[model samples]
Target chain A: MPEPKALPFSARDATCPFDPAAELYELQEREGLPRVPVPSPIMGEFEAVELTRYTDAKDAMSDPRLQMGFVFDPEQPRTMMNQPGNLLNYNGADHRRLRRMLTSAFTVKRIRGLLPKIEEIVDSRLDALEAAGPGADIVHEFSTPIPTLVICELLGVPYEDRESFQRRAKIGLDVNTTREEQIANLAEMDAYMGRLVAEHRRSPGDNLLGSVVRDFGDQLTEDELTGIGNMLLVAGHETTASMLSSGVALLLQNPDQLAVVRDDPEAVGDAVEELLRYCSPAIALPREAAEDMVVNGQWIEKGERVVTSLLVANRRIPGAEGDLDVLDVRRTPAPHVTFGYGPHQCLGQQLARAELRVALPALFKRFPTLALGVPEDEVDYRTTALVFAVNKLPVTW
Target chain B: MTLKVEVDEQRCVSAGHCVTSAPDVFDQRDDDGVVHLLDGAPPERRHEQVREAALLCPAAAILLRERDGSA
Candidate 1:
């Protein structure tokens, strides 16, 4: 394959420490906002396009020509990037079909029904925390477990197997993990789901896995089920965990904000929005252009992979009228691209909301004295990985 | 009073703040960590607490409004 034309700049020039957002902001300053050719060690070698501006990114998300599962370089081998067709990568009819089928699981009404169960899990985890004492790693002790258990239950996976699967899922998302290790973790998840799918086929349960097997047993292939399971499993747990752990950690650091939340737990919804904008866990979503396109006035060729930095877009950018970054929960009709935009919007958004709705307020009320165990600078943020997250958020109440 | 409550599930990252604020009204199921509203209307004594719950929502999924006619 031939090398693509040189980008106007290097990521290092625009890089923000711990957050690549600085580079995006730099581009925004240059009036070269969208399609800025974000240089990625991964995308650079592959000659893919990069997207930044909100409008272009959303448009590419809904575009039909851009293929999700299509492999540009056959020699690159089928790895995590080449996984079977799913909503995030797929376009047109297949995308519509899969989206429709999974839509019900994400609706607010459907998610609202799961609240009681969500509370039970959180309480149970808090009970364990009491046993462990005041100082605990909220990420592992509380944040990680709650969502892992929840998604496991949703997928019908035995709760007992959650720790191991969670380990595998965590490894799969680790960008620093050796390519082989990453691929191995993904394969391990796929194999595990394969067995579950087979078992469910023989004697299906009432879980999401069994439902998929029953409803689209013929249409949804085993790998497809596994793919969807992987999506649900990883996405379902990881991002939500980041939000909880990070949200608490942030509140602990910002006492005034913490007091605001403590005074009105219902403000959790607004606080979460500000947090999502403030700390967008899913920092960037990679998209590829199927044909020649111009975004934010920059020309982007076909077959280039682009990533929109939602973290940056949510913080600083001119919106319809005012600045988009103001962190005011009272800002009425505030819309965020944190869950993403257009066709690829997060399928598990409602479920994510319900979890926060129950968890955030409960956490504060349970431990009114809850505050960070360490300084804000000391908190371990997930720096190298694709997802902007923290490794461990230690807190004490 | 209208006893208005708004839920922005989108803002909810499933942090479980509401459940702690008002256990009787908010909860986290064993099944999923997502927050749900068990009772549409919270108790009067807990109203202030529920207001706190709404504020703490990491996803900002919960909002409260006081109805003009009743409390």
Candidate 2:
């Protein structure tokens, strides 16, 4: 295979914002895993191998040799990465130790326990949307707040502090933000989490953070507790919020699929899976090779970075059924690397699934005639961010 | 028919997919969330749910085999 082109991190096809860049797909088809330049705000630009095949992406995610800790440059003051107990900053035993602490909080049974609250939150959001009248930005009025509030309750964040926390989280996740801004946002959130952790230490609530404080207060340090709180607060809301907004936009584009999600109760689970695969909220997850190893027949040297394009890999050939690129809610759920794969597969996926299942159906069912308030092409999709999302999804009944 | 169930502790992230799918057959330790097989040889009636639990294990940690050396 010829030397692959050095593509920028934010390069996506402008014509089809939903799909990965044409160059990425073409390179993957020609050379299963292509070498490309990955630009990181904290680490600057560096060469990294891109995994585009779904099978390879899934398998490589579990490879012990591929470490996530080195994704950031050590010299740079990555406050978020340096935070103790941040799962993404660790691999192997350390990662497992931190992860296990919160695993019980996100177990299927625990998530199922939270279903009633999730439903109530979804219903309340819908009520607000309706009362606001038609022509509301679904991203703001509906998609964003539901997960934000749910996470607030889960992390024991005060309801009054949600808006400020949400603002900081959005800024923290934005790749477009400057290093100074990112650090500032992280510091602010860190302080907020510290206060919350202290409060939990005195009297732990039933929420995730509080439970950890109550159960293992002696084992965990203040920094570790705050880190756990920060990770959940940001990840719990932002990723799901992206899916909610983008999933709605994608459904509107295909009314046939929309009808299936809206009307068929049995199809909701599969619909959420399909949407997760189709939307590919978090574009790529970056990992560093802990040691030299062969991944998908490519020789990746130790310390080299490997970035897997979840968006492209999920949409690769031989998908669920029919064309992988097309949105079909009725299609059987095929394994995709959207929530990622391996031991580190998303901790809160079940909760995210429950949110989508309840929220999407209720949104469409409540307003059967719900349509895009703006032109389809005019819908502003987020391109430069780590997560693929729409800027605003304006809709009307 | 009897179901022989095993959980690879190293691979298990304690997502609880197995526990949720087959509660009677699987349980998790209090110290860590990793699952443990409650009934190694469950009756024939629970075969399907046990298999479903194995299939749903996100980490691919759950393994099931029959006494006759069949999966």
Candidate 3:
């Protein structure tokens, strides 16, 4: 593969946690693929296309030619345990059907109804932090607990086993863990979810897992349930938890932004939207072209694998006008591709929003003087992480 | 004239930008993840934000029009 030349722009280098678009856009100009290649052993085997331009990325997302359900060979580096009929590996009507069923669970009203529960979870976790006194790692003590507990509660996973479940969830994403270790963690989670579902089947609860089993009992096979459960575990917990830790840290680092959020709690909604756009946690997911298509004069053939960087697309581009990159909550109408676009956008977006809305404001309301416990330089940025996050975020109140 | 907004469900991507922009009038449903119009018209004060939502609707599904007793 030929390396593309860098573009002439001075955006934040890839290292800057605040704005990493400069380097990303440069890669976009380079042969239209981000220089940071998708880490897949099958790079030579598959035709990899990188969609970085705003129009191209959005087009790729909405294009019917792109298949969402294509499962790369399991031997590939990023392959998870293969389960047939999982939502991630479906396209067209199948994708639509699964999305319809799951989207309902994440509706704003449903999520809003869970606000009190979300608050309880956030506050209880915060209480634990306060009891532990200063210098507590907020990521482990506060951030992880809220979402972990929320997912467990939502999926009818017993809260008693939460700490262990949280440990397994983290290990599931640990790069340091050998592939075998990761696979083991996945199997453990699957088994736990399997047992939890079985218990729910014997005596159904009001949570999402029971609902799925009840409504789609005949439709969802055992493996399907496990796949959906695992999807929820990763999507329902990791994304929200990462946002809480990193978003709060970003606000703390940018005191001006934090002050804006503090002055008017109403800004929490806007701040959360901005944070989604700014951080764009899940950087790239593999997408394959279902048919030949043209995007911005570039022709892409069928059966091609393309990765869209929502991170870079959310930021300002050289040819694009307006402040797409700026993290301004007050922007009258913000346009962000954080939750994604088209048919497969985000099933849990409203739920994620609700979690953020409740958690961020509650944190400030409880600890008005909250600030980062450690210096910004001392903080660890999950740079190589697929889901942008921090391992530890210590905050002082 | 009482202004009203409508989202063509077919074109709607369930982005919930409408809900975020004008939560009082537009809310997403807990089942099937469809957008529900809470009120025909938001409070007169929030009319501006609603207008902004119509313009920002990527799918162009949201339509804003003035309503009178006789249409």
- CA lDDT scores, all candidates in order: 0.66, 0.81, 0.70
Give lDDT for model 1.
0.66
DockQ of 2: 0.50
Off by over 4 Å in 2: A1-11, A71-78, A317-319, B1-3, B19-32, B38-58, B64-71
Q: How does residue A67 of candidate 2 score in lDDT? A: 75
Model 2 reproduces a share of the real contacts of 0.50
Two-way TM-score contest, 1 vs 3, winner: 3
Total clashing pairs for each candidate = 75, 0, 4
TM-score between model 1 and native? 0.76
Interface RMSD of 1: 8.8
Error of 3 at B30 (Å): 5.2
Evaluation by TM-score, superior candidate among 2 and 3: 2
Worst window of 10 by summed lDDT in candidate 3 chain A = A3-12
Clashing pairs in 3: A65-A290, A69-A89, A69-A90, A104-B32
- Using all chains and alpha carbons, the TM-scores for the candidates as numbered come to 0.76, 0.91, 0.84
Residue A154, model 1: lDDT of 80
Candidates in order: C-alpha RMSD to true structure? 9.0, 3.9, 5.0
Question: How high is the TM-score of chain A in each model?
Answer: 0.87, 0.94, 0.87
lDDT winner between candidates 1 and 3 = 3
Ranking by TM-score: 2, 3, 1
